[model samples]
Target chain A: MTQPQSRIRRSFGDLSERALAFWLLVPAALLLGLVALYPVGRLLYTSLFRRRLTDETGNSPVFVGFQNFVQAFSDERFWTALWNTLLIVLVTVPGALVVGLLLALLANLPFRVKWPIRLGLLLPWALPLVFAGLIFRWFFDSQYGVINDVIVRLGGERLLWVTTPELLFWAICLSIIWKSSSFVALILLAGLQVIPKELYESAAVDGANRWQSFWRITLPLLIPAILVAAIFRTITAFQTFDIPFAMQNGGSSFETLAMYVRTMSIENLNFGYGSALAVLMFLISFVVTLVYLRYVRGADD
Target chain B: MKKLFWLLVAVLLASTALAQQTRLRVFVGGQQRPDVMRKIFDLYQSRNPGVRVDVEVGGATSDQQQQYLTTVLASRDPSIDVILIDVIRPAQYLASRWADTIDKYLPAASRQELLRRYLPAYSQANVINGQLVALPAFADAMFLYYRADLLEKYGFKPPTTWDEAIQQAQTILQREGNPNLNGIGFIGAPAEGTVCTFLLPIWAAGGDVTNAQGQFSLTVEQAQRALQFWVGLMDQKVSPPNMAEKPQDTIRSEMQAGRWVFGTLFAYAWNRFQNDADSQVKGKIGVVPLPAFAGGRQASCLGGWQWTVSDFSRNKAQAHRLVRFLSSPEVSKILAIEASNLPVFPALYRDADILKVNPWFGQALPVVQAARARPQHPRYAEISEAIRVTTNQVLARQKTPEQGAREIVTRLQAIYGGR
Candidate 1:
């Protein structure tokens, strides 16, 4: 009995030492909670309440029980923004991924075009997004746009790229492609480098051609990296605002969810409704991340 | 050895403290021209020898506002001591108690001087709930710009009434033969610029988005007439079809290109039209007040920025001094000449030296005096956006004017519910 009691004492002491390490981490953990999670928590808290401009100034935060969210869901503008946001994501994510992959493939290839092309592919991402937006806007301008000017000079009709609602999406997509496809390429190139060359060598020994090897080996191996890149790209595309906002100035047809959140919050001063919309966006992106982790990461792992 | 090490450590710590003492971190929006901003800040630093003000300008207006306001609201010891604010937002800041009311610090004589010297409406706009929330930092207002040579060449006089203006535009369109040589270029974009520039014409024609009772002011017939007139400009091809997307600057540039004969523009446009190296029609452009709508009073827009102190500023006294100094008549005149901003102080507009520097002041000063402010509601930004969106929709042919106007009224009611 005494031997067992002594063993318990020693185990308790060991446990205390482990506990001391956790205690040391408490400050850092609390700091993360305060700095990172606190605003998110406040956003979530505000999302559930119904408040107005008056409520924001000195009125005690009241519990309205999902009314703000309900209003957000019912608001046609919210749905319109969601639709536009989804459309932007749908157009941009796959477009960026495919183009990025193609560029990365060309960049990864051993050719006379390799270094210059690689540098060029990386240039868009290197340049500031605002500059990229302005450049694309200038290119797509109806009258002064170099693109339109060239077209008109070549005896073609001028196209109002940012004005036409139908064209606004494509113009924004063009800029998104210009600014972000390079980021996608950079991410994929990093992934492509991590891929084992020996796998391709083995496939070559098995008599697989370049295309077959790429399809069968390189792509499969790169899936995890591709998934990571896709998830980030998707989140960014859904929150697409800067390019569209810069191009069209919070346009009627091109109001993305991110832009609407700002429009409602700052411009409209409906912080509660805006907060609710933002919370929904957060929940959506978080769920998307979780799903990606479960499906993509789990499959890879 | 221990004594020597302690002495070195103390010396290093002392230098670090000194470095930290003189640093002042500031934040501003990226909308300002970066080169000009750098020069301005460089001047600020040179003038204040001991203070090094570090500025971070964001790319977008909304992003800058959000980041700056969030920092000010949440910081235990306010991180940013200076902020550049949009004019429409001072009401919100004042109401939320995020901005300091500078009236207490400003001398009564200076405040009275501001009132007596500036356009009455613009001066009143700088006041919030009877407290001087901000001083007018820069002034902007729409002015009626007509082609001086064209009107004279065609033996036509500038119209003083809405009907006369429309007839003149129609007559010009009929006679010019060139589709590009329209009578007017209206900023029809579904943006804030559209609301500021185009709404002036509609409101001057006796149309309003909201009435004095703060209720929705657009009747279906009145809204239809406004839309008809706006689209009529396009039907006559006076405004380009692409105008639904064109920004204010684009129209200004086009006008400078002599493609359009007349357009409404901000007062600062005089600088761009006459002085821009790229301008072709320099010294040929003319400024006047927008013509009155049939039986309606003429109204231009009152748009400008105001200076305010941050509620959490550590140096409120210094900030107040800066505000007073900047708003002084002398500073206003200097800025008017240098920055090409419309002087908000009336005295500067009347000053002989200012008029000498800005010859167009003779025409533009009256426009500023006659300018109409958007609504007095703290939610004017919200109201403005709804008007912009709905107006854009109509101009884009997506919705009828009636539908768009009604929708806006509904949104306005929703926002201002039970107020």
Candidate 2:
């Protein structure tokens, strides 16, 4: 009985030690809750209400369970916006990855001009997003646009780059590619640097050509980097609004999910619907993250 | 070296402190020319010493509002004292009590001066939820700008009705040939621009998108007729080849070059048109009211910004002072003369200086008088979105006008039902 009592006392002693460590971490834990968790929780709570702010004096936030969600789902514009967003992701994600990989490969080349080429390629990403958006808007302007001017001179009809929904979507994708490809390239370039060159030298000795070496060796090794780049690009593209919003003013076929949420929350002042739409966007982004975690993170493993 | 560094730091700190005293941040949109804003600020500061307004330009109004709201909601202290709101949004802000009411700062007589001097619609735009929330900073109304030279050369008078307009435009275009001229053009791209500039013509054709009660009053046949007419203009070879792709800015540029016979545009372009620095038809352009639809009245959309005080602002008195000063009759006249901003006062319509400097202003008075505001319901933004989608569907020929109209009605009913 004395031995059993001693053992119980020892167990209580260990529990207290761990409890002290956890208590020591409480400040940082509380900080995280304040900065991140609290806002998200608040957003979720706000989504449950109908928020109407009139003249700063008459803000009435009332509970309207699921009504906002119902409206968002039933609206065809919401569906069209969703469709447009998906189309953009499908077009932009693969295009960005391929271009980034190509840029990385060129940068990894032994040529003397590689450094200049790499810097030049990455210059677009270094520029501010808004400035880049502005430049692109000017580039795609139909009447005085350099793009249209060139097309017309080359014996092609002028294409409305910012106005038509179909053309507007592609124009937006072009801006995204210009701004984001360099970022992807930089990431992949880092990944390529870490890779041992001896593997490629050995493959060459075995009579494998450059294409074969790339597919067999570089691609497999680049997978981890490629996955990381895609996760970043996809997330950014999903929330993509600046380029489209700036270029087309979110009126043309270029209204992304982010733009829709903005119009609802800010323009329409329907915070409930805006919140609901934002939550749905969050869920989509969350699913995308999970997919990346499972497929890309799993592949890395 | 240490002493020198200290001296440098002292100088920097002194300068920054001095700068802070005069610095005032003013936020504007992406489309607003930064250089023009700088000039305006310089002019404002030259008159008002020791006060410098810093411009914080953001994206379009929607994006700017997102940034503005997030800032206001996040800051414990009200950082933004004066806000420039779209004319449509003052009501929402006034309703939310986000803006301070202008009652105390400007008494009844001064306020009445504004109502009497500016156009009724312009004055009314700022009266959101019965509180005067903002002063009109700039006014933009749709005006029919025709090729005066073309009409005079071809012996064709300005058409009074939509059919007459189309017939006259066709005659000019057929003779002018494809490369030299297109009959008419517009902003038909699927954006706010499309809805703003293009929808007026449709509404003027005696069609309604939605009623004030938020019911969709657009008939399937009427909706189809409107779409068909716009597309038919292209098919009948009246408008440019890529009618659906052009923005209003492009259409304006083409019209300025005398490449297009006529176009409808915002009145702000008058300054550019009269300057002749870049225009081919600088002296040959004329402004008039948009053609009326058969058995229907001409409609023009009202566009501009209104000023509102933040409810969260601690300096309500100062904010009120700013609004009143900005809207004062004398200041309104100065802005109209110097900045070419339209006077918001109904009585300012007869201002001699306004007529002397801006002949276009006199021509636009009738258009502004007949102008109607967009559906003033809280769901106007949503209504705009619905209109954009349906218009695109029609333009793309993906959905018939009847089908698009049905879709719009169903969608609007859902929005109303949810509310």
Candidate 3:
């Protein structure tokens, strides 16, 4: 045992820096595998069968290779949830990005009482998702909600915000943007700090107006930050669950992919189909994230 | 030597007795719920000194509790020995093997006597595969609550049929235009309420969602006919157009706010209607059976909880002992008085205290007796979802009754046997 232990120590001492770096990373690499690969593996395994939790005759667990996936292709709810996810990401990403950039620019200005403005901009991001959902839910409630009260006071009809299909989806998008825009703003603010004051001065000396400098100088340099923020915000938006769940109970109007997975796995107890859906969700998120990463890398190159 | 041997034997026996004493964790919904159930569990503990029973009040509502239970049971964790069972959950729990049949723990002769003594609807809800998986903890069923003042002023007696209710509602809506009031309040939200509301008419019409053969016994016509009647209420302006989205709680709040001329709500809301400080319709309401189709039976969907032993429990004996004690007639009476719950035992209705608390119980007894249960399929959650989806569609005018029926049938078929 001593001989083997000494040999192990010698091998570690002999390891090259690159190999040693990898060797040192083994524990973290294992942790990453556990955190990421285990659930995906379990999901993949469950997806390979009809693993309904209920032992009722028709619902009995049985091997049904790729059948759940095949069924998903034709499921209207699955398609609806998928469409809603894409629509929400489409709405929220740009919404947050534009708002984030504006806030960042405002914050970067030579201004008075800067910390309060920065804190106010960052406050929504600091709130938990559930709390944000509750606040926004109250904001849009058709009855006694603040938004409806203002509308009614202004001689406008109270919209059925959480009930109407299009209105509810937009409400979800609005909630997502409200909750995450600050996070993006913070990222852009950090990016803004790195830009030298001389670039703007040089642009000004070249007869460039503020708008022209903003467009030509700040815009190009800030693209990297915007891209980074957009990639992360897009990924987060893909897994939107808590806000919509809090807004309404079980209407399929605003069901996202994560919502569908939860409804199937948790509510319906159809773990097999739920797992298949989850695997599909993981794949989609992975692919989207990779695509965004590749685009960012390409831009850098 | 003999005295020493006897002392050793006695000591060993004492230690064995101590080791055999079992402690159990019983999970229930809401903090108030455990307080109500504590008397029974306390009684259980007193009788069995060897057992210690701890009541855990978990989720705020039955829905939340069910979700927690589902997660825990899905892992087959033994943390919960005795669990609260929603009326609609026995089939699901039994099918999943999350629950164990408690028949073995019950005395055969006493079990038969108890079964015969309880209300058939209440007892039957706990039976799956002819095995006693659970026992009803209380009695509850849905009811049609109306604004007495509005109905009297409008010169309408309580509607005995769905058609009459709608006609009366339409007249009320057209004439009143009170802006503070609608014709009717309904539970049309896509949660369990919608399914329960839809089940009322379906069961009244002598239809069921599925049969015991694991078959889709619900015909297309049964669903379409029910949906046509229900959706007509919405289309004719007798029911709120937003009924498809308002949950039962919303409708209840509306009812208590004096916002609806007629409302359908759960029986538990009877107390709140009369006594809640927020109630705007206090002393202005009357309870009645759910209106059915003309020439059809009046029906309400049964709603109650059961006490189920977890399959993973090592202390099932202690759990069942507690269940047996809590559901006993005397204890059930105490439960009714303590918790303001309707009793599962038929005899408890005759109790003066119970009748006093819920004065509407006398008028609603027939409805309770006739209350219909949902399908006992193992995929009940999915089946219930189908009901909610289809009914919401019909109410929303997104699908015609016929199309809604077709969609529901198709979805259910896919659930049971699909590609």
> Tens digits of per-residue lDDT for model 3 on A254-289?
688999999898888888889899988998899979
Candidate 1 DockQ score?
Answer: 0.29
**Consecutive 10-residue window with the lowest summed lDDT within model 2 chain A:** A52-61
- Write one digit per residue (lDDT tens) for candidate 1, span B1-419: 99999999999998886776455555556644344445555666688765666776754544346544644553434656556666666676666666778877758887786567656775677687778787776677787788888788778788888667777777776877775676677767766666665466557667666677656665656655666677767766656766676667667888888887788777767778888898988888888787787777888887776667778877676666656655566656766776677777766776787788687776777777777777666666677677777777677776777787677667777667743
Model 2, DockQ value?
Answer: 0.30
Provide per-model DockQ scores.
0.29, 0.30, 0.47
Provide TM-scores for the models.
0.81, 0.80, 0.89
Q: State the lDDT of candidate 2 residue by residue for A97-175, as single tens digits.
A: 9988998888888886676887787798889887888788889877668999999999998776665567777888888
**Poorest 10 consecutive residues of model 2 chain B by lDDT?**
B68-77
State the TM-score of the second chain for every model: 0.83, 0.83, 0.89
What digit string (tens of lDDT, one per residue) describes model 3 on residues B1-419? 99999999999999898788787998988823677677777877787889878887887656678788888888889878998778889888888888889888767887788789788997788888788889888878888899889899989999888788888888887898787678877788777878887777788777777775657677888888878877777778777666776778788888898888888887767777887899988899998988877777887888888888999998887787778877778877887776667788877887898787777766666777888887777778888878886787677666789999898888888776732
Instruction: Output the better candidate (2/3) by lDDT.
Output: 3
Clashing pairs in 3: A55-B95
Interface RMSD of each: 3.3, 4.5, 3.2
True lDDT of residue A298, candidate 3: 94
TM value for model 2: 0.80
